[model samples]
Target: MIMPNEQKAPLVHLANAIGTMSEVSSRVGQYVLANPEKVVHQTVAELAEYTHSGQASVLRLCRQLGFKGFSEFKLALMAELAASERSTATDSDNEADRYGALLKRLTQSMQKTAYALHAEQLLAIAVHMVKARRISVFGSGISGLVSQLVSYRLMRLGLPAQAFQDPVLAHEVMTDVDKHCVALGISESGVTLDTVEFLKRARTAGAKTIAITGRVNSPVAQAADLVLLAVPIEPLTIGGDISPAISKIYLVELLAMAIADLSHAGRQRNERSKTP
Candidate 1:
């Protein structure tokens, strides 16, 4: 924990910033915010595992909030709890506050993603997605996890979508790419070598390529026929830190919604023609 703060600063900073932390960091932050007293009694591993985040996330959260490490964070927390009055806030109340903060953060991120990526652009790409014979999404690490989510969302919309975490497997699949196919890649930095290469090859194979990334100048974007700006976000969930991935997830949901709308409108047009 590198960001330095005073004794009473622990809870204060955490309550304010939990809304913006990475998923891992946010999990830890929310828990601590809800139960600073419980955390002061637990070890680093205990809290990390309990929150389903790693010890590193706990330590990172501590450092970012101005503690040297979990030890110092605990000390500060203890001091804050000691200085604070005994609260009547129920367990349910704390849970609600923690969840409310997280929801607010997610809502803000979704709003940012929408404003950053134009509706016209999203609809244009969505048109191709709806008409594509098939769709392949590539990603690695946490990005790979996001790819699975994207695939699942599109699949739920009745689109043929698949996610590839392994570059080699993605390569084999790319061999099947054709003009009717759509290839999408997710990489926050837009420079992830494997994801960029996959999109490049898919484009070479004649598929419409899309990239969700943070930079327009990135190799992945350069290889893509269309680029969906993955809003630069921080403070966890759907981020590569869980926050980075959150932006990507938000984009995918928007794309899915667009596809659903387009499909509905198209069906309505067909119905009207038949009725006449």
Candidate 2:
């Protein structure tokens, strides 16, 4: 029952969640990761036995990775294996192989992040933008670029939006953000102290807060009223320490598009009302 879903990567996603998975689940994940080629051709019961865990544990692991069940997980695994095998056929030059691997990593991370985000949440964030008096976007380092990117998109829609890269200045502005403002914090780690502080202070001032971060349980998410999860995959870059999650850009683009549609609809309605 291999489904060979080209749009999703089960192995990539499972690896990402392995860090925070339970002991039993981690064991199951490690087994599949270590022997993906073997596991792809095995039955559910066999995999469970191989991992020294039960069938339920195997099934549970599948669900946690956002698959319907074992069959779906197997399908995705088979597809990933097939794709990897195709890539391997072109390993003539070592440098090409390395470049291909990094390219695949970046693509897979973006795909997983796009797959993980929910449309309802994106729409909800858009709804907030449509109703807010002003928008404040916060991020540091690479996330700062994402913040500014999204802020510009919002401005293009004629929404009152501003990007705040400086935490000190952001903090000063947060004081003026009443319940009418929507404060968005973009962080790859979600634990950036300055960004988290901005969200906390924004909430304290009765502003609507939203966090777009890779960590679901991070301080920024905990402080904000809404959380949008993205992949923390970063490029091997020369910038400072690590670059911001590339997934952040994808999510913000999705947000901007959603907000645009909502903003357009709202404007049309307003014009219609005035015409009467």
Candidate 3:
């Protein structure tokens, strides 16, 4: 799908700025705006040839427009095109008639989650996991189940960790947490009072806390030292639906992979240092 020429799309902005760019960059930008369809489908080499500009010029144009690279620029262009198509498409009157729309929404939600995720935060959490002498995961309901999965995965990685759903037992465990402990709380709504209390208690006990929730402003988020958000979707959901649980699992898997990678890298570095 191609965006309307009248719209103020990302490419339009680049085209608008053509007057302000260097001569070579201006050539690349002008070619992109003039051949927007080609820009979408063509590789950097192909696009450069079409624009009669060097690859460096094309890359410079992307950088000048604040994109990290050509691939990111293309992705942004595609997103804008998708938005345009959605805006122009006729709506389905009923939910059942909009199955494709629902799927699209779910896909977009995951994409938005990826965009919202902060790499530095994940790295910081991984570092904390490596340093912590013990890890305790806490939650209730669906989130509690996800917490248990997280604990299981961490233990499988040879990390000392456990999960608790009982608020009383979880709190009692928090009392043993100290500077060397990492307490993780998983709550979709972020308003789970028991989870919040457990995090608060753990933090007060001098342990570092992490919150995995949908709402950043919730009590649980405020109590934790680090927050990792999972996508929340409850519209038109049936009772006891586990749609949001899928997102929670996705986030936990990401954390587990990061922790494993960091641990593996550390071990390899240690082995290298011990080499004769």
Candidate 4:
């Protein structure tokens, strides 16, 4: 059955992953990029035939791009196509059209990231924060801003939190982290060496580690006891390199809200205990 145009696919995501995939998967990705409409309508076998690749390779490509299979990939393409068609259905260069396209892209970043993250993991992180002696946030570059913002939010909630942007100070502070603390690392790429090192040191010191990153399999994610996936905004999007920050902010805000709820619950318990 044909899916609705409102459904969104991650075409740009596939394109980006292709750059890191093996030759066979890259071939499949390139084929889809070159003929999205045709590939979407065709079966996986047909796509494999057209790309001169095996059906397994096509499936592998879909999974690599975070799809369940070719069917899911096609559905996403259909959604992208639908969005594209709507944007172009009108032929005028009006301000509305320009702004509409911009809004769509920005919302897409949040939707995609939200879909990628699991609620259970987020709740677990909140619980960890509720139980921790302190929460230390670490990031660099644009992620540094995210780290600081999250730290401030935690503090506003009456939690002991700090943001570390400098590698030297991060190392120095991490040296004092103990098992009672929580170490949270934010990295869009998940491979930032300094951030990963901080996480490692924190873990060695027995602190509970959490990683917020776009890459599920990244080193930072691998090192953390808990992983919170955030949708990465493409640099080529409407806002350039700052685009991905939207998704990061979205995930952090959710984390903050969750932590707040946990804190509220704790306060309620304390009040009830006092009454008894």
The TM-scores of all predictions, comma-separated, are 0.61, 0.68, 0.65, 0.69
lDDT of 4: 0.77
Candidate 3 regions with alpha-carbon error over 4 angstroms: 1-102, 234-238
Model 3, range 1-276, lDDT digits (tens) per residue? 223343335654664465566656755664464345557898999988765778888887777777767887888877776664664343344666466555654554454445445667888998898899999999898888899899998899888999999999998887788999999999987889999999999999999899998765568888999987665652324658676777677777888889989988999999999999
**What's the lDDT of the predicted structure labeled candidate 2?**
0.78
> Which of the two, 2 or 3, has more lDDT?
2
Candidate that would win on TM-score:
4
Query: Which of 3 and 4 is ahead in TM-score?
Result: 4
lDDT of 3: 0.75
Best first by TM-score, ranked = 4, 2, 3, 1
Model 2 Cα shift for residue 220 (angstroms):
1.5
Quick one: ranking by lDDT, best first? 2, 4, 1, 3
Per-model CA lDDT versus the true structure: 0.76, 0.78, 0.75, 0.77
- Candidate 2 lDDT at 275 equals 100
Off by over 4 Å in 4: 1-96, 234-240
TM-score of 4: 0.69
Model 1, which residues run further than 4 Å from truth?
A: 1-108, 235-240
Backbone atom clashes (below 3 Å) for every candidate: 20, 1, 0, 2
How does candidate 1 fare on TM-score? 0.61
Error of 2 at 276 (Å): 5.7
